[model samples]
Target: MKKAVTILFVLVFMCGGFMQAQVVKSISLNSGMVWSTQKFDYKDINYDLPNEYLTGFHIGFAVEFLQHEYFSILTEIGYTQKGFKLEVDITTPDFPEGGLGTMEIKYSYKYAYLSPMFKVRKEFRGFIPYVFIGPRLDYLLEYPTDEFSEESAKYFNDFIFGMTYGLGLEYMFGSFGVGLIFQNQYDFTLAYHHELEEGYDSGVDIKNNAFILDLGVKFYFGKE
Candidate 1:
């Protein structure tokens, strides 16, 4: 985590050093689709583990704090519906029946991210090359599925915090612009729980992380 922050700071310093050209203050809107590479683990009362992934769309805004032909710092926010399904093999201590079933867990994640990104735009062309790294905060809004019980719902709250980083490309034509961004986030908090009285133990040596690959378009409000 500390390393990521340090890298972002370094990028900001570099952008500031080359900020003698014209700068613009504007905000842009972004909307695109996301594909989840891995399935989110969902646990049931019997401690069955199901694997799943999500495919959905996202819409967000990017507010430029400092923008020049070479670099920019932007704050972005978006709402996404990421859903995945987990399949657990039922041959364990609780279920000796040896059956196979699947459960779908859906999450509505609202995200707010602040990034100090650097871009290298052409002097006469509209092509822009950019890279971004920053911190991201996610709030899980809805987690409802028929496969999960009421007690399990409490374990899957709608709040998450993580770090985000990515690289992208953008093209501007006057005031109208389009961008493609591919970002991924690492979730530090494992938002998983069991029905045990002591609650779900944290040290299970399992994987608790989330990420997304985004391809979107952005409209810069000012002259591109």
Candidate 2:
């Protein structure tokens, strides 16, 4: 992480002298779809289950460091919800006084994420194409179910971390700028849940990977 920060600093300095002024500044709003394609595994136990991938929406913003037309420093924050669905089938034993029974258990796990990005721009006469890459930090806000009998949930919220990279196009329109961008992130940490309850203390797990794609527009505050 220190090396990454040093590299980013070097790139920033190489763009221009310390006194170089910003040519543009902008704030963007985005809304797009995100998806995850992975399976869940119980971290501490052998309780096996089948789960399907999950999907949701993303929203965020971007800031530009306008030292050079083709170069800029950028940071963005976004929220994501992705997880898996589990389905289990069980057959009940036949009762002499009653009848046999079969049932299916279904549930899902969701994760929330916040990402900070560093972007580099490639300039043209009227259109600017840029690529961005950065490290992301995530926190879990909720669990799958409320089956725990304890007053406070015993499950620990896991941290999700990953890397991101993608491209975008920005158009110059005087003081205000307009653009569209797309990017994807993959988590490197496994997300799991531990049951501390006495009787139903079975462990649960979720997929470790996810992807996000976003489209946004930026409005520059200062003119070149």
Which candidate number would show the highest lDDT if scored against the true structure? Answer: 2
* Number of clashes found in candidate 2: 0
Q: What is the lDDT of candidate 1?
A: 0.55
The TM-score, computed over Cα atoms with residue i paired to residue i, of candidate 2 is: 0.63
**What TM-score would you give candidate 1 relative to the actual structure?**
0.62
Q: For model 2, how does the per-residue alpha-carbon lDDT over 150-171 read when each residue is reduced to its tens digit?
A: 4434544456677777888878
In model 1, which runs have C-alpha deviations exceeding 4 angstroms? 1-24, 37-50, 87-124, 194-211, 221-224
| Model 2 stretches with alpha carbons more than 4 Å out | 1-24, 42-50, 86-113, 146-155, 193-205
lDDT of 1 by residue, 72-102 (tens): 6666666665555454444667777766563
Worst 10 residues of 2 by lDDT: 98-107
